[model samples]
Target: MHEKIFEGFCISSFILNKKLKVALTYNLKPEEENSFEYAMVSPLSKNSTTYNDTFAEWDTIETVNSIKSALELFHNVIMIEANEDAYEKFKKERPDIVFNFAECAYGISREGQIPAMLDMLRIPYTGSDPLTMMTCLDKARTKEILSYYGVPTAKFITAENLADIENHNLEYPLFIKPVGEGSGKGIFNNSFIQNKTELQQRLQQCLQTYNQPCIIEEYLPGREFTVAILGNDSETEVLPIIEINFSQLPSGILPVYSFEAKWIYDTRQNPLDIFTCPANIESSLQEKIKGIALKTYKILRCKDWSRIDIRLDSKGEPNIIEVNPLPGVLPDPSDNSCFPKAARAAGLSYEEMINKVLIAAAKRHKLI
Candidate 1:
């Protein structure tokens, strides 16, 4: 028995040490791109509120390099830009596994573009599958799934046109944002609509600007928290919870973590004291948040890792704001990225965090 157990352990160690080829697929932001160019090209170029958040969801070269560096520590790393040629690249190289976080720029199915290709090629990748990726990107579809599972989520309606907003009977002070965006794209202080006229105007603006359906959700009034989760079923680990302190935001700005708040105001030179890790909450509340976050992760079929945004309702119950299967990892402490921040709070270095995600995926693929 002892010899058999020892043999099994040795084989496991051998498999773990066999370095695999890792394709670091990403959508890199154009180095020279600026807000002026975005605004000039925007449909609402005449509107001053138009800011250059076009590449907001894409990763910087620094971020892609950082992830590549981390993976190189243990495996052979290959960089693949997620674009029209990405499918051919994957077909040619066919790495052992893909560390995919390609937020492709285009249609409602943008986020799932790379994943769908990988699926067709029968290649494994990190995070959720194509269906889950597309669903989570479409906030309305995500909310619908959550609601169907009896998960707590804010009441919301998708407005493709002004008539959709006009037909809604939901109460006022609602939050409006592009249904298929992440990294705070298309979200701003004015996203908070107080009355019918403002809602109609904002809805029209979003439709014309974003050229996509907008989800108008009944705004939750209590404190907000974002939970980062890692691993998979039965062994999934919830990292330290991070609370978004609205009080720390620039005064007079709405409490929402809009594009301006995330990218403009909170810079490395002058960072906003906005996040509180391991949020000062009762143990019961922590468990509640973790429970809901894990349930949401599983229900959405999120694999490897994900970050779920939760806010408290008037009754203080936690309601999921949105789900991020491909959570951002900026790799800089001062950048104030929530996933890395939460992982740091849980005592994980950025490199460790990245490797853990890869390991999870490799294990899932039975590659390790």
Candidate 2:
């Protein structure tokens, strides 16, 4: 019995040193009178308010307290907000590791910006590097790379403006989305188009609303499954696949995982809306999904951790959708998201999951 337990170990230990210095980096709310005011008055209990109030908009004291709790296993964790002078601060007191969670600030690069800064500084951080982060942010670019790597993905076209769709070759029933935004931003039920006129109209709306190129892809009209990938390269592990059950979805809806379906889970109060991890799927299909996720993860050169969004086509083949380089870490038991959910399925709690990722990075540097 003891040998059976010992057999489960990987027989390798990379992290040998004591707890390393870690900086929990996050982006501060851009300093503006209106932004600051909105932060102050936002409802603290609301889920939507959590993004602004809980992380970026919260007072420094609140953020520091939160970080301390998250990094309870570490020896020292310094809280650093992403700002103009943050790089200098990082240089002066370079931490052994950086827990980068800077989503964005004031309509800037948001996700890729801080990672790029860290790349230049040569500081070790969790998550994908700058290039992968930038490519994945632009869904079009991500699909293109996946395609080049022979990964199956839905057919898509890049529409720079309304005029560009005049002679486009995309199929009917297309899904329009912002080229670089996430969290279902700029995606709504109206994004589905069945004809040329609706396509042009939605294209115009996306252009005007997002002020950026709109990506148009053929709607898969099939089940949506998300695969959560952890670790890097040979050591990588694929968590149980998550299948988004849309049974609660209203009839006639094409089942787009819209912003509301994701962020408003508790408000809807529907258990079916939640993610069913280790989704009930055939053994063959499960293997297929795992293979696709692993292929996409490697093709993108994603490191430390990442999550791949996938959808099954009419023929029941897994097609690559989008890659999330920096998945959210909302530890609120009320809002346990996918990344953490998968970690729990793997027998790791929130704190253990965080440390596991840090250890993965340390293994890469042979500095654990």
Each candidate structure's TM-score, on Cα atoms with residue i matched to residue i, is 0.92, 0.84
lDDT of 1 by residue, 347-367 (tens): 887877888898788778888
Cα error of candidate 2 at position 21, Å: 1.1
- The window of 10 residues in a row where model 2 has the poorest summed lDDT is 49-58
Model 2 ranges off by over 4 Å: 1-15, 28-68, 106-109, 250-254, 265-272
- Clash-forming residue pairs, model 1: none
Query: Where is model 1 poorest over a 10-residue stretch in terms of lDDT?
Result: 35-44
Best by the TM-score measure: 1
* TM-score of candidate 1 on Cα atoms, chains taken together: 0.92
